[model samples]
Target: MSLSSLRRQDAAVVRSSLALRPLALAVHMLAVGAAVTALPVYAAEPTEEAVTLDAVSITGEAEGGLSDVTEGTQSYTTRAAKTATPLKMSLRETPQSVTVVTQQRIQDQDLQTIADVVNNTVGVSLNRYETSRGQINARGFELNSLMIDGVPTIYEQPWSSGEIFGSLAMYDRVEVVRGANGLMTGAGDPSASLNMVRKRANSKELTGSVEVSAGTWDTYGTLGDLSMALNEEGTIRARLVGEYNDGDSWIDHHTNKRETFYGTMDIDLSEDTTLWFGASRQENNSDSPAWGGLPVWYSDGSETNWSRSTSMSTDWSKWDTTYESYFVNLEHTFANDWHAKLGYTRGERDGDSYLIYPFGSPDPVTGLMGGYGAGSYKTNTTQDDYYLQVDGPVELFGRSHDVAFGYTHSDQDFDADTRGYIPTANYDFNDFYDMPEPDWQPLTDSDASETTQKALYAATRINLADDLKVILGVRSTDYEKEQGNSKIKEDDEITPYAGIVYDLTENLSAYASYTDIFLPQSQHDINDNQLNPIVGESYETGLKAEFFDGRLNASAAVFRIKQDNLAESTGLFIPGKTPPTFAYEEGDGATSDGFELEINGELAPGWNLMAGYTQFDVEDADGEDVNTQYPTKMIRTFTTYRVPGFLGDKLTIGGGVNWQDSIYVYAANPSGVAEKVEQDAYALVNLMARYEITENLSAQLNANNVTDEKYMDFFEAYGAFTYGAPRSLTASAKYSF
Candidate 1:
């Protein structure tokens, strides 16, 4: 069935569910009360008996641990991660460069959304297409690989139109792996993979937190999180998280409202078996979202210096979205010590926009802008994903090794429609605020696309020596895409992964890795034939170290990536099309070379620090810069220090600075002369402080862009610009038990 029909049914369901919410809440409260009353059954009277220890063996942690998946520490450093490989390994053991943003850091920075997280992450950048959607880039490449609880999923781009904007309250932490991840993500970019680890119901007792915040730009929000053991034996647990936000944008007539709900349950089926189920729903509604940013130039070939609040959107313009998801996962440990897992997830997202675009330079004589239009647009995307994997120890060649095998299947559908003549009217340039809203046309089905992918993967970690290890893996993928009358198929592309690590000392390791990339192409050649997919190789070498008994971590890495069969426009116009079409050819492809350095964790007893610096250069086959609008150099750092003995250890202070090199775009003027508009190097400074008012109450204040820097965070090749946020402040209070 069409997505529109499904949306109608879902809306009705939502209305009915709203009426049942009060009853549901009442039942939940009663259940909590009963559970609390039964807690005494598990509590024993003061025990007078003494216990004796049999053995004092201090065994090291295994590659995979239950605690690694359940609890995320607040420190800047983490001991183990599962993003690089299915098995959890120490950061020093992982060959690739990885970064983790823990829940504590998210709260300290007051990060509300994924965009905020990406912007603050080292070596990553954001490009806002509009207020409702944006893009993320790392290592000079667009990032498209996204995973939730290790299950691969694709996010709708450009429009975002989904839970991409949802609050981060539901996640334990965010992990990023730089470089190709073909072993885990079958078909994707060679740049980076982002994995969001969800919050689990692991608390054995009643524990929760509630927070409220008010910020500049009339932004205010509240969040509540609760977790508890469902029974006295603690065999079952449940957790729920909710958030609400209402805010006004820096642009005139722009406002945002968002709501999110997430819940999960964990059941211990047996001593060695477990089951998990989770569901979430989110809605993000905005009024007067920008179709694009402010124009860069006037018709007279002079630059336009507009205020940050200058908005080209009409009061009637809006972009609203809804997202929902459900998932289940099961795991069992065999008698032989091997572990097996099976998981599945289904997700749906829909959005509608009453949009207006004013896309031209003003008339030099009449000061009138003619490129105006309005339309009603609707889009929906759905995804179903499954995975099964098993890993255990096996003796080989007189040595113990760990091996893992897995299968994954994913199906995704996306569709969009639009109706009406946009810009029903145009007005003079200076009359933007007084311009009337255009009567939008009705919406109808326009186009649809679908893709399905299946893969089988396997990997092994060989302990070649006590201080040496090797990882070998491969994934065989079959992918298919259908768009209108065109169909593309790629059968069984084998991508390989290889890595080696050697302990340089007790606290550090030296490693190198090579990854094969496989990405399907959507571009067409001169004759309309689909271009061959991009096939590439990535190489990297790095040094990783741990300090203070794993409380601190650092890494330095250098890498290079090369891809072939890249689609490049020939700059020639075909005559038969309605207007004209540019022909494309599989050209020389592109290359990127870069290096990164990062250090994070506690520097001392009372101080915490996180710092990183990165630089890269990218060029197309012709040796021309591919994306000059992205900075070639960047440095970001932040640190916090606690006041000892003063104010009873209740006061903490922190600050950070983010700096980037100049970036520019090439555009043509009315006279057809190419000119460059550049945003010079700039830095943004931020300060934060927190104070505990009582045993269960605390307050924090955050000030961003303290320098009040004026700069463009995103610049389009065609002269559109998205300016960075100006100076703003937010203060929040929280209570926990």
Candidate 2:
């Protein structure tokens, strides 16, 4: 272990030097990445419930005079997406709170990943930890539903990015369903669902793009996407996307890297049907399996701000992970008013990493924070999953009604191993630090185990009238786990969902929705059996409007939610026969409420706006503050305008601003927490100007974090903290054909 630590420590020095590498070159490559086309013309362009038959076409993208409007209440698409946008419309006309982050906006703001995009959208809060290194939540709810081309892709928890990183490059536009989608989505805890629309083969010719980026912390990476027609008729389409990113964490000594490869094929199985077959693979590298996500402060019990730079593992800190997935989908349209679809997906994951954190130390003869005997969770994960769903339209009465119903299921599993080493187990605390990298000392024994889950769900949509619609759905899941124990930890649960949309006028509407999301507990009972899955429900209502025939849209909404089956983790409770351990007590809770308002669309001749406000409260079973870890009230906004360019509208300039109020951070437990730290509200500004040197070529510049405000981004219960990013700027030239 000592030898391993020395090598890693040496690597750290090299890494620190690497972080200082120039990023301007990387930015130049990225800014020109997507604009790879050359010289002819510089042109660019850019969720259902469990209900089976959804009929509402409530979106800002409906084109051709909104002639093909669905009977449903809301839906939106990009200028070139699932649906065409109406002619010359304003965003305020859409009857839903929508925020469209255009590619131009993405570039202007230097948005790096999908997370960056969502973080910019209104009413959307990204809650993630630099440590723990996993999971994205909205409205304090874990994101469970992900849609690719309208197909649901549920990411398994305790899972790695080997699966998610694939979607980042292939995505063309990202649409978010802010509330319950149980009608077709099945089960959700009432947070938000995201749909990643893929770049299609709609173009007549060939198109490709590649991007590279480098930023603070020596972060540099590349992504490539290429699309082509496989048939003379241009009916069959093929697309491939790949990526490679390697970088370090904000903290010292931590490292991360990932690579992705994906291929997708689309065939006109028939005029009325399209067939999709695709696969993706991702590889990940890291030293710590714990993902540095664990809190640094020990709830005021001990080790308060001890050392933020301490390595969690003494040895075996490097982790290697990989994931592969394949999927098949069919979309068929019949001569009748009926349409049906089916899809199946298979995914697999494997990982091996080391976990090292100071568990405890003995009394020091001299004294130091370090000690010998240490335990580590070093292991491999092997997971496989399968999912299936089918849906079509159904008519009930004479009144025109559209309906769709579908069922989905998946099986997931993982294994984690724990290892402990006491190379001088008898050494006194004083000598622990005296010995070089004592935590890296020799290993002793190791143990392993796994957890599995199975889920089933269905949903549908029903059109009530020319102005009203209803959506409903449900999902049932079973969670089972075994951790070196004979008894099995089993749990069965069901979540329900519903939504309604009412059109008051051709350009105005009202909508309401509810959904429940569920998840199995990560903590196990004394029996080593998994605990019951936690469940949450969300209820929401809102009003929306669309103008210029749905070219633009705006909306206001309010919601309330409740969560149950939460683990208290008292750190004070012990099972009857179980020895006193980490007190993770069990408890139930509910009652969280919030209101939101937002606007997204073309407001004027060439102006756009995306803004939102939210006030919320989350409590425990006793109706007390459980979500005090974060802020309760916040507002965000962004606006941009494409001025009638000079030299015949060829010279374009635009800019935007992002601002937020102070947020509350919890440094300790509710009882022992330090004084709440109030983060001063700050804003970041960005500007962009492009000159059409030729029809196909142009020069552009982008600046981000304009204010250079120094601030903290995230804070955890254990007092762990990370700082926000500093300012950055980039310039590039592009050619499109």
Candidate 3:
């Protein structure tokens, strides 16, 4: 909700970028400062050319929010690193719509939760609720890919409607790569990929900071981040972040509290090679977890579906979960301008949520008793992953080419169980009033179900000419699942990708890319016949440029995505041994095609900006032109301006607007007629000004939803809708040595 604080954070990055010497490390750090340091949202504007083409070594987005553009961006990047550290370059240097929510930004805005951070980020939507369970919607796709320090940490465990509630308190910055990333991702959903960078050793000597906050609903919390340099050479550094959050929501039947501890170490083995290691541990406990979405309307079965509010359940027990993860990565460079990077990680998640919802109990037609059925269920999840990558300048024929090649593999496992239950409801009660807390059924034993997957993939990038560059990639996955006494194994074929970029000027470039992904079947069909996974592909083209030695940047892009041979299951045969049966009913495919334009950069003095817009058109390959659930278009913009000299030297004022177009969901009919549920387009205006009380202390007032924009965040699965948030505000102060 706080936008101003974010702007000041950007000012801090600009300040840092300006102060750092032109050391490779300093350049790398400053260029990408916006992501990890929490820079203010007010980025500078795009000028003539962001980065000079001669210096356009990497396809640039590096023109960054602080940098300007000579050519359009081949991609749109969030913020650049503080310095021009090629090894640790900024996101702008990467040709993609990548955003970095830095640590400073995290503090300035008082963004205490992961959901809060995602909301402030461009091109992302929150589909998840509750502290223990979380979900995020991206470019009309559900996110299923995640990494910690460039290591795989995502699994099939998202039961509370998502994998787990992630906290932002321990992170340095969040990196998001929009669109299909299966080329480097190995095996997973192509929707998008997120890399949560943990706080690493930064203090040249010894430094630390602590933050505490209290908000509505008795919400209170504390956070601490510390760092130390073990040697004068500053080659060995260590950082630690810890947080404890305890609170209750407006819900009547739930209580919850959570804690986390994270530690990271970085050693500059040598100027050519650096090694890093990170670990994280988290714990959560909650009661009456909203098993699912609240009904759109209640009692009379009338849709109360109102805006500015949404709710889950009451009295969901212990609902506890534990997450433990560790990772190690190394990067090296050769005299021939070649570089190699390798990383490995292990992650594990265990938890359960208990709930029994209303099901098959009644028929108004017969009144013979069949309105709702009740049952208790629990789920268990686990995961393991490994990856290796290497890219360098290589020789092809007689041409000197910039080549990048890498490979990755992943293995994951998941299981669940359910038991019978009895409820006090034989009658229809949408209000959930006068409900009965009946006793449990003495079922004999708990039933179990399990699933697993293994994948391997490789990819490469080639620079064919000074004006033309290309990239290619491929991946394969082996998957399996077991239910009761039955098991099934399947294979997802090769996923490949290719791209090309053309430099129009010394500061401008145009590029195009094609990427693909293969997804596995959801559940088993009747006769337990196997169904192939869908092959999804994306086509994109855009422009890019960098400015101010990569201090500022800007980009614009357009794309088209399509999926073929989609598998639709049908309940064909009946009375089978496997119990539940499904059939693969081949149908028309689905395609999402759209155009996007983004402007990001820092203007002269102390101004910063980041904005993006997306428009989508999707339908079955048969061309029925169905009203898609995804927004037709979205645009979000934010900026900040620092005051001149005197008493105002340390003060900054900033704010921006975020808007989204209407969306449509299937109608109320059993057949689901396409009901164009129009979500009125609303712009969120935010304001904030920060003043440095001291070199180590600062205070900021952040206000969000300035206009009290009302809207729906999610609707589709079981019900019609859930509303978004209303005008809200928060304030905070921070101190750092």
Candidate 4:
């Protein structure tokens, strides 16, 4: 069957699914109601009692310390997090599945980029479309929300932007909350939210670290970090971080260079007030990068088996991009233990690229290929955002509860220009390495747009009893966008959130949550009118546990996500247009049902572990599978052990494996016959070893893809795919003062 036929069949399934939503929702609500009613039986009255215990004094532990920053913590888990809600709560209290990739984990796994982090994260997947661009997905939906210090930013699709290529040297940790996050993000997909916490100037004395490394394919890199108190009274502090990396790829003529710098300062305004500011810049340049990917089939109607090092790029092709950001925050604490914060951020992104895209397939025998297209493109984007939030404890029913209120406003502008050239003559596929550059035409305006968003949100965590707690929140958003002659605006869109957590025992708890988000669509219907925004609703229930004084965390969760008003193509094009546009219609949408199990933390005195398993199925109303390109089953795990008897407890060794089930896409072969292009299930093995040479110096080595597995990193319905990296190794040494 053709791709179009598959889509039509999926649409029919969607309609059928829609007809059953009312019944499904009714049943879900009834179940929640039954649980709420049964809570009284589990609640017990508190009684005063006296107990004797050993008294111990712990040194080097501060009161009300910074639990959000996991830089100095060697454990894989944290005591508490505020990513799911503004209020600080343990993982078991948030009523959502949360994962924190701490600094220790980043170093243990040698993760250098955000893409690397996501690929190793539980229940999350990274889809690499090209060398420098990719998408992040979870729960069978693309993730579009990114946050830094609780501030949100919307990134464009992977094909158009390089946002996912950001470096991780400036961040102390990454926090991910799976499911709908409309309360904090205001507008986005229901997949997941990723928040990166920046490292701060928290030291009172001079402290720093430096590291250098060299790896396979002539790759070398260096990193430096410094922090110190600038004032004699230790009231003002500053920190600086920088990194530089250059590497040659396994693919012929492909090379990458990256540079990053970040600086931050914190000033004490008074005994209860502080001002913080920071600036960061990152630049990435790639030479001879492929525009798309290699063809999946040859002209003879047989699958093509190109070498992993094959390339379809010319020597002159390059992609150069830069990201710069500035932010300021003021925070005040009251005598009542309440806090208020005001913040502002400005971000800018610039890109310049010259690329060539190969089309059609080559003859298997002669290696002759079809024509190619080339272009020179440039893009610039700028965003300014402001927000104010107040959060503290409130007295409700003679009990202390947490509540927060906030408002945010953002404005963004984008502009793009391109020059294009197409070659009519066919060339031999074997000659792609020496392909000639095309003479591009003069640059002209391609697209320009402006967007604005305003939102108001509030949340409150109410302590109903000693073992029961409930959280309720809501958000109202006003969004608008404008282009040359078109405008799309949505006002007063309301999103609601609710969750309940009940303690089952001292070490375990059970919870449930419901939330929703709205996404505006740019597609138009047959009437030439824009379609309604898509609405996503998510329901989840889970069990959570903490052991060894919160050193280890575990969670088991089940979730279902439903989307309404999804746009589907009508197989008809708008008439009288230079470039034809497809007409679409509103469909009932799709549903995803899944579950996740995760565990992270220290299992023993000198051992740390992080592991997770995820499985989900996505189907339309008619129960037909959709989004088949994304795997339905995945497992990610890593662990490290410090040998107490070996080298006087100075050596640590670790290893991990990441596995995903098979994925396939329907595409047309070179002979115009529809076929399934699939990638078999695969796993990548990684290993690491670190040795403490002295009290203040260490050496480490990391090996990735140890099995030398050959797999595709990305695949599309257009019969193009990108290959994953082969076995590689890196060794480094670091010194601290």
Candidate 5:
């Protein structure tokens, strides 16, 4: 059945479910009352007795501990993060470069999606190839691993859509670790890893907020978040978050509607044991979504300058995506301070798109474009992941150290189909907006794939001296994949990690780390055999400092990365293939050298700041620049300052700027002449102001692209480009209890 038909069939069910929300809440309250009343009670006179017990020492901290929660911190940085390893450690002790975007920052910037976070994050960039899809990059490589509360999710570019558009409403913060992360993620690139920490049911009292906003391009949105204890003892708690948004884009005939819902429960079975479960769903539906972007050149081999509002999509075109995730976690703390956790996660993604791609270019005088084509595509992906981990303090040479052991298993299945169609007639560039939608053919199977990974890993943090520490880890991964007629298996692939840190002063530390990972490829060689996995190695050294009792942090780092057995296309199709396919070969690979500097946290009593600068150069073995589509130099910074005086104490103001160096791609023009399509260096400016109307009410205004910069947000070697969003404003009112 068609996705549209399915959506139609489910609409009524969804509406009915929504109508029962109040009844569901009533039932939950009743259940809580019943549980409270059923608690055992003993009313017996007891004789006075004295008991003596041995003193117990706690050794390790549990995952998602209070130290990692940034929701109530009101700061731009957290005190501790465990994304790089199972051991909870401060940023200065982690060895690798880590950046945390806290909840305060998210609200200040009005970041709604993961893409928005990435665009504002340090050392990260988003390649928004289309309106509904993007590729995240860092350190001259693509990031393929994403974690939700430490559970890994693998994303393949071809089959994944709207993953980057996941809603951030349910998250407390986003943690980014730069460089190879094989210690936790079994197989992936050396670029970086992202961990999204969810907001738990931490508040025992009924506390919540409601926000409503309106913005340019006919955008409106509402968000609500509620959290409270479900039992009198506060041992059981629950949280619910929901959002709805509808907007029209700067692009002609484009409209978008999105809905998100998330709920979680936390139950303290005992003083030392806790159970957590949550489920989330996000749906993004759009009309007239752009597919590949605008043609970059005219037929005369000259570059074409199109209006920012120009679009190749018809009114009937759309790209809709939905993501659902469910997770459960159990944690226990032993008498010796040891911590053990078991977790399971199920993730599903669905995408349905009917899009048009405009080909060729307009004639310089006639303004007539060559042609346009359309396709109806659908994809579904499901992943199941399970993990067990234990960590505790160990006595070594009479000194206490930390050690962690973990095992993980992940299974993913993906299927895609397409109903392809092509229009027979050409359309004028000026008349493209009136083009009619094409009739889509029946869907046919395009691809199907299954992947599984199992891994065991261990790490230890050893304290050699009062001022010196070292961390060592290793992982053994077993991976298997089945697609088409090809089956690939790799057993016992070992990845190693090492890091050392020395305190230079009470507030300063120096660190160095090394790690490596491998990436499997689907590309085939000339002999129709899949290529070996790419092996990546990263070496990094850095200095870190803290101030104001760890309330502020600063870091500077330099790094080098090398990848072996990288795939390079041969520009030739395999012989006797029904459908032409490009063959690939193992190349000499590439090397990337870079440096980064950053500062985050509160600079003063009412001032919060986050700023970073990044620069890198990557080259292939032939000494030619590679991955030119990504900027080699970037600066991202944002700050907020609340007024201090009596009259102005209720107001806050801030602004920021993001700048990137020029990027270019080589592609052939309509005339078949190879040319360079470039986007020069550009900077976007943003501003925000918030005022407290009362103790429980606040209003905020955010302006993005204040300068109205005209730039291409996306461009590739295919001679297509997308324009960035123009200046826009959003005003919101929020109420808190």
Candidate 6:
């Protein structure tokens, strides 16, 4: 198809704030001001009394290695992380920018899903393709890699059942590592990596908690968690968590429900060994989901705006998704102070969606719009991932160093079925609002595919000096894929990583890193042969600091990334094909450059803060900005303060603001006129308050989009746009023992 013809066909087809009393407000203000002034100045030499606040707390033996704080706390800063490197090092020593959303933060913010957390994460942005599917981007590139308990999995449909809609009930904390993580994650972009740390069975005594919540739009949900020791010695423990959610959306005729269950067991095989096994299931169902957004332009080449609650889908449209996983792990420590671990995981995800994709712009004069195309698709994906690794001290050049080696293997299978047909009753733009449902036909087999990967990796932390360290790592991967009648294979692909960190002071450090990027490509070349995998490189330099005895952390970094072998179509057409076929070639790829500054943790004993600023630009080889529809600058911040005396530490209040620069994209109207649609700069505000009615009971309220800011959340080059969510509120009550 020619450019003009393709354009024509694409056009047709694609077509709350909280209230405050004056006296209560003044008290709150004075308390807030006092707390702010009490914060310790990070760099200045502390006075005699200031030293008391920064006192360090130490627990547990080091076991002759670096120890970490794995438990979650209300403070924004976490003591350690596994995503930055295999060795659990504090954020300040990891040589990377890391963010941790602890359990306390999750509850304080009422974050129910992965999307909610990503939206509030600094240096991250959320984009929804439609009402039901969305994606998260960091540093101007899409994030495709996710880890659960340190095990990695690539998203087959990120917008559908991947991290986008993952439940938060079963997770203890969410860890985000910015920049390239290709060293341990295998194949992925340098954008970022997200790790969901599961809540372990750590209770030595019987302990449980239950929570219930209700919010705007008739949203209601409940969560139950129980844990107990199975033996007198408390050597064996088990935990179970379950959650249910049902809610009506802001859009007309749209509703959604979700259910989740998780169970885990921990056993001590001996004083030096331990075992863990677990299983989980999650299901989501949506009724009357919008297939696509309203038209952005009229036939007259003029812009159009619609109400936020408008819907183009009928009552019959629905999307149902289910995901299940099972995992087992064994860990042991030897008398020589060496540690070893073996892990295995298997999971499956399935989704069924019935949609009506309406295309084309409406006629301004006649109010006539193009009709809709109806379709349904069901997909099932199964994956198996396992790895073995061992780390210990090695004496090289009379210096003790930490070394680790591992082998990993993964297998995946996928199948899909689809059916589509035109509705028996059709209407034009004049009757678009009242269009009826389509008569769908039976489903038929679509396609099947299989993928397998094997890798060998090794790394070491060399102690160059008492105050300096160096990390070197490399991964060798073998990959294979079989889809339909096409088969592809690649062997001996190697990716290297290196980093160095120097302590500038007891509480500050500077670091630099270089990482090679590797990503498997599914696109084929003009001759139908799978193109070479996209390979890239990244360089980053940064400074990190910790304050208040590691209770607060901050970092600033600059980075640049480049990739090649990007898939680009030739635009030449092949006849005798239902939709016409076009070949592809390895093209000059993408480049991104950016900087970020972030700070998170307890600013004071009663004050918790998280704030970040990001600026980045991505461009194609031709030097044109890519994804210009996304803002290049953003600022995010939120904080909570505990008020003393009157409430006896029973009341906590906080708020947050998110601001982004304007975004714009170029597109062609139905009349073949070129135009730009843009969303101006906007700021969203949110407020929250939680009060302890009793020692074991608490009540909390949260209001989002207090100002009811309205703006475009997402847009495409073909004249389609989606609006941001409207104002909303939620209230919850929790009981615990």
Per-model CA lDDT versus the true structure: 0.76, 0.52, 0.56, 0.81, 0.81, 0.76
Q: lDDT by residue for model 3 over 131-250, one digit each (tens)? A: 345566566556666665555567444454334366776665666666776655544554566766565554557888776666545667777888888788888888898988887664
lDDT of 4 by residue, 473-529 (tens): 998999898887768788999999999999877777889999988888888887777
Clashing residue pairs, backbone N/CA/C < 3 A, model 4: 13-621, 13-622, 14-621, 17-621
Which regions of candidate 6 deviate over 4 angstroms?
1-72, 158-163, 364-367, 428-434, 522-530, 569-585
Clashes of each: 5, 70, 102, 4, 1, 6
Question: Residue 274's C-alpha lDDT in candidate 6?
Answer: 74
For residue 580, give model 3's deviation from the true position in Å.
9.1
For candidate 2, lDDT tens digit of each residue in 596-647?
Answer: 6665544544555556666665555543444333445556665655557457
Question: Can you write out model 6's per-residue Cα lDDT over 25-135, one digit (the tens) per residue?
Answer: 234433433454467655555322101100011111243443333342466667677676676467777777788877777888899898888888888888775777766
lDDT preference between candidates 1 and 5, better one? 5
lDDT of 1: 0.76
Better of 2 and 6 by TM-score: 6
lDDT score of residue 662 within candidate 2: 56
lDDT of 5: 0.81
Error of 5 at 465 (Å): 0.9
Which prediction has more favorable lDDT, 5 or 6? 5
Of the two candidates 1 and 4, the one with more favorable lDDT, higher being better, is 4
Model 1 TM-score, all chains together:
0.88
Q: C-alpha displacement of 72 in model 2, angstroms? A: 25
RMSD in order of candidates: 13.5, 12.0, 10.7, 7.0, 14.0, 7.9
Report the lDDT tens digits of candidate 1 across residue range 260-308.
8999988888877778889998888999887776777788878888888
Better of 4 and 6 by lDDT: 4
Pick by TM-score: 1 or 3, better one: 1
